[model samples]
Target: MARQRVPEGPTPPPAVQKLRIRYAKRGRLRFSSTRDFQRALERALRRAAVPMAFSAGFHPHPKISYANAAPTGTASEAEYVEVSVTERVDPERLRAALDEALPDGLDVLEVVEARPGALADRLQASDWVMTFRGMPVADLERAATALLEQERVEVTRMMKSGPRTFDVREAVVSLTASPAEDDTCAILRMVVRHTTPAVRPDDVLSALRAVAALAPPTPPLVTRLAQGPLQTATATVADPLAADQAGDGT
Candidate 1:
């Protein structure tokens, strides 16, 4: 016979304010995965005395939600999360408190009272900057040019379920290679749409290798510069926090 389920305990206090936060994962901390970040966030919340609201259940978890988390081992400047609190708190103060509570390299950059819409709906694309050390900038430029000329660039990756093949070129909104600051480095910047399986920077790199045989000696340093809705005319991504800023009259 199946075991009977236990009933939920009493509901916690209702949330009075919901805040959206923008944070950065920099340096060594970029290696931390989503699961690791979640655990750290809960610890920081408790240490900082954040008045978090809890779901009504026997095992009431904090009402925290994450969106568009960057892949592990990649740094990000525009990661976002939303949290419900039982009491009102100044966004800036909360930012400072949490920033101090968390370890170095996982910094809370900004916070705003959440606006009406879902955060995921605002994240249509991401801007990424990839630095390949010891690679020639001119080679990257040539590869980027060839990539743009192509209608589709198919690449394969192993998924949790199985291996999958997809065209990384279809999701690329913009691609460009920048002049290196130093002789030993090359940097490529790209804006890609969030597709069904989501084309990541590594996938694009795989396509480049396939088409142009451009390969870095070591793993490229990847950093997400921004993430938000794509503006097709300008080929730019609107800041996801714009609506929240307007709501706060900032």
Candidate 2:
């Protein structure tokens, strides 16, 4: 005899779908991938008594989606996650409940109803602010000049399956370096493609390193600047891959 599938009842009236979360990754935890955070958040939601929609299967789980996962060892003041709920709860109350269960470093800033459209749909690119120690202004300027003058910068590497090439020139919307408060350190403000072939802070660090040496190595720390649609406010966003020529290392 074959096992028969149990029929589920009619779906409940569509309670408005919502994903309530705003976060910033800080401290050593910046090294944790987005997937790890997803598990952590899922646990937190269940502990908070937040109701969630489950898929129609034996091993179903609450539907939760994260916008973008920040790179490991990189701190980000701006991060976001989307979640679904069947019951409407006061934003403040929901936030408070989650906060009590959330660990330190993972701050719950807001629980606003996500505006229409998925985050991936709304996001055009990400801004990254990176700091490197022991880099002088002159050398920094030279590297920037070399990188920008080029039409495109292609960085090659082996992926999960095989080797691949990526164009980062256009991916970098804007690249600016400034003196950090530490003086010996410099900061890079950049906008990169948020999509797959996703440019990372390490990529930028490598670019600068290729032109000039960076101090205090060992997987330099990274921090997410922002994730959203790019606009007239700065460096023009273009497909770095679509760009004509790419430069050294990456």
Candidate 3:
């Protein structure tokens, strides 16, 4: 067998600093797949002249880590990623540059120097809001009540291996329904704990259908409002990057 030669060169420098970014997916950008976002981000980094650290290998890649990205079709205001850079850069400046480089709907909202702990660990829960048109708030309230009354809501999702079923009721911390301003639409706000296999908004919708026979005439528009540590008492999500920002004395 013939041996392939490895490309030889001086190795890339070790990362000097790490920055965590909070970005938003809105409008049409919510439909972008994770891989699409990755490609766009890499191009934006290049255009913004970020000093990204590279992996030491024949096929070197940027040192970027994504944590618990929202499902492709759902919009999110709190998607997170961490990046390592060879040179220290001002977080605000980087945020501005990256926001300008990327398309309008994929926005960089905030950036902070990483603190001591893992970013993923801080993401303990998510707050989601789903809007349904032509659905009355009274019907939604009844369905939410039924879903909460259940001991368990088992839902199935098709995985790569096969179909798998799990109880989504335990993961739901709180669920509430309200009338939208238009009076013709209904809105549901829920706080769900991040769990194994990750219960999604769609799974909850399925559970509602199974439990209360509530079905929207049109597809519900779902958006994740926040992703961070869960406050047990209030059933709310706190800012994940607050600790890192505190470390910077900002």
Total clashing pairs for each candidate = 0, 12, 0
Q: Model 1 over residues 87-196: C-alpha lDDT tens digits?
A: 99999999999999998999999999987878888899999999998887888999998899999999989999999999999999999998666666889999999997
C-alpha lDDT values of all predictions: 0.92, 0.68, 0.95
Candidate numbers, best lDDT first, in rank order: 3, 1, 2
In candidate 3, position 77 carries an lDDT of 99
Which number leads on lDDT?
A: 3
TM-score against native, each model: 0.95, 0.82, 0.96
lDDT of 2 at 104: 71
lDDT of 3 by residue, 1-250 (tens): 9998876898999999999999999999999988989999999999999999999878899999999999989999999999999999999999999999999899999999998899888899999999999998999999999999999999999988999999999999999999988787899999999999899999999999999999899999999999999999999999999999889422
Ranked by lDDT, the better of candidates 1 and 2 is: 1
Worst 10 residues of 2 by lDDT: 240-249
Write candidate 2's Cα lDDT for 6-44 as tens digits: 656654444465754777777867776777787778888
lDDT computed for candidate 2: 0.68
Query: Which pairs, if any, clash in model 3?
Result: none
Once fitted onto the true fold, the runs of candidate 1 whose alpha carbons sit more than 4 angstroms away are: 1-8, 248-250
Order of models, best TM-score first:
3, 1, 2
Least accurate stretch of 10 residues (summed lDDT) in model 3? 241-250
